[model samples]
Target chain A: MFARNRSGNSQVLSTMKAKQKRYEALIHAFHADIYRYAYWLVKDQSVAEDIVQETFLRAWRSLDALNDEQAAKSWLITILRRENARRFERKQLETVDIEDVQVHDDTQQADADVSDRELHRMLGGLSDEYREPLVLQLLFGFSGEEIATQLGLNKNTVMTRLFRARNQLRETLERQGENRGRANG
Target chain B: MDELEFRRRIYADPEATDKEVVAAAKADESKRKFWNEQLQFDKQLRKAAKVDVPDDLANRLIWQQSANEFARYQKRSRWYIALAASVAFTVGIGFTMWYHQPISIGGQALAHMQYAQIEESHSLLPVNLDMVNAKLASFGARFDEMIGDVEVVNFCHLSTVRSLHLIVDTPQGKMSVFIVPERNDIRVPSEFNDQQFHGESIKMQHANIMVVGSKEADLGEMKNIITQRIQFSA
Candidate 1:
């Protein structure tokens, strides 16, 4: 009885250790992209980092529910999206206007081109409906169907949002280019 | 595919490998140029979206998780400690209450009669008036003179109320006298008994005097003697 009890306790301990290892691996693999997605979703770096931390913490708590390793990316995104929605629900009045907050990255701003800065600000200025699908495509390389599934939207809607998102950005860039060209001329 | 359909698909996904869209791009030189330009634009958009993540985020996450787990463990064990402390506190209160439970004076005097008999046999020094007075001084009372032939006198407890016991021999039989301090919480019953002896109590100035003897022995003489002889100082 004593030997069996010891073995049972050891088995539980080993399982906990394995879960921790898997959790650390998940964090290292997805933290960067997850943070970027959160940043674009909220248009605030600190809030994005907070949401990412909360997402990973929640993921750690429910890591056992995740079975397939392939679904991990979408799973993390799902948690992050929910975390963002909950943030709005918790602080509805405190939601920051996306246009008011610049997408600030000190390291990128240090050496990025003038056009790149304008593009970054334009991306941040895009509404959540358009920017979300585009960010998923650009960052995780998720297909339209995958973004639709992650966002709980139809594939056609995801495709249309992606199309409009790029079209709006292209128009903005072209207008900016013309203004700069005319000024130089 | 028409130009509008081609541009729509290409805008949605610049690297659209759909055969129809690819074929349309190849058949029209302008369509091919637009697709390539969109592709280049998508590359820039991808770059803008790839923001820099903080350097120590991974370490902070792992550290925070472990700290949370440690806090949860501490909270659980603290709950158990609180439960055990309250249990210990309850048991301690129960034992103290049981130890100090009230007892009837007559019943205790009768109970002490058996032990008094054994004590009478072992007692070597004959208890005198002065020796009795010395013990009674603590209760602020003393006997004016020897009340009876006190064979043995000692202090004893009747349900946590300290008192003095005096064993005496009389003409009728042996009688036991108990001088219990007056306490409002302790009830001094006027009469009580067991198989071997019966007892009676009298309320005095500073104490209650209980007299116990055999069923046939008259306790009135001992009660009267104790009442008249014992004195409480002002």
Candidate 2:
């Protein structure tokens, strides 16, 4: 949505065309990434979808603000994060941890085995602070600095949190192993 | 870096970008094994976190935006039309064959294209296709869902034959579609398009649906959409 330009209707027309191109390109490029990120945040497919839609709509409204195309991924993530936050602000959802909520899909069952399931369950139990950075790192291959920028944490803090996050995950799996060993004995 | 630090770094990020950590891991067999195990664990966590995404989510979002904007534009344009029914706006260009009678399949499309700039304005349709479909339902022809964004969904008085008029957007250009529940008994040709355009009429749910588009358009895909997407109210 470009402002009518003084250059001519052609300028306006070209700008409109460019806007559409940017919008469609952004959707094509990041729809899935945004959708997945939103899904993890909200844990509901429909709500996540609505967030992604709203995020893109906002993106379209201010596409001119997006100067560097390289930043589009984080840019979209920012929009989606705001949208997801808005969702909670609007109304209180059940807000249960997704790990506790029974996923009706086969994705959970497709995990390698019970240990894999426990890992995912433990991941869901992690606080948003640790979970967000770890997911950002894995989902986007985002480095510690990128995660810091994304979450507004210092790079060192993000690395330390990620380090603690992995340690907790290891502790969880080891505890599960201990229980299994005891049951067998 | 020391082995303890190397293992700790691997625990933090199995695929760590730290060159020193990666170099040490590659250089030592124990560090290499530990990193491999951590990498496998990271991969599993990623897969566990993955969820199924909707198949047509992208198209749905695009359509949602386009339809919303089109609705806004239509709201503004409605006033301009309401102000006048002048000679130019009232040209009623297509539907010329009966110019008054209900047109046959091919003629309905042929008449619809008479406006010349038919493809242009026809693309900006009234956004409420359900209302348009209800109007079609009056003639006993309706669709469960639209396959793509349509520009025109209205009734046309081509020669006196009342028919449902539709112009759906195609990749190459706009394809004019006319559905006549009244003309199934009428003898209709299979299909044809000249240098200027391409068209085909296929019988659907006891209705004559003729679609015509520019030569560049894929009438095959157009036809497939018509058959697959449109289901009778029954």
Docking class for candidate 2: acceptable
Q: For model 2, what is the error of residue A68's alpha carbon versus the real structure, in angstroms, after optimal superposition?
A: 4.0
Candidate 2 lDDT by residue in tens digits, B115-143: 73444433364645586667777766556
Candidate number achieving the greatest TM-score relative to the actual structure: 1
With candidate 2 superimposed using the best TM-score fit, by how many Å does residue A92's alpha carbon deviate from the native? Answer: 2.3
**Residue A144 error, candidate 2, Å:** 0.8
Question: Which segments of candidate 2 are over 4 A away from where they belong?
Answer: A1-15, A103-119, B2-4, B26-28, B74-234
After aligning candidate 2 to the native by TM-score, how far in Å is the CA of A43 from where it should be?
2.0
User: Candidate 1 - CAPRI tier?
Assistant: medium
At residue B59, candidate 2 shows an lDDT of: 92
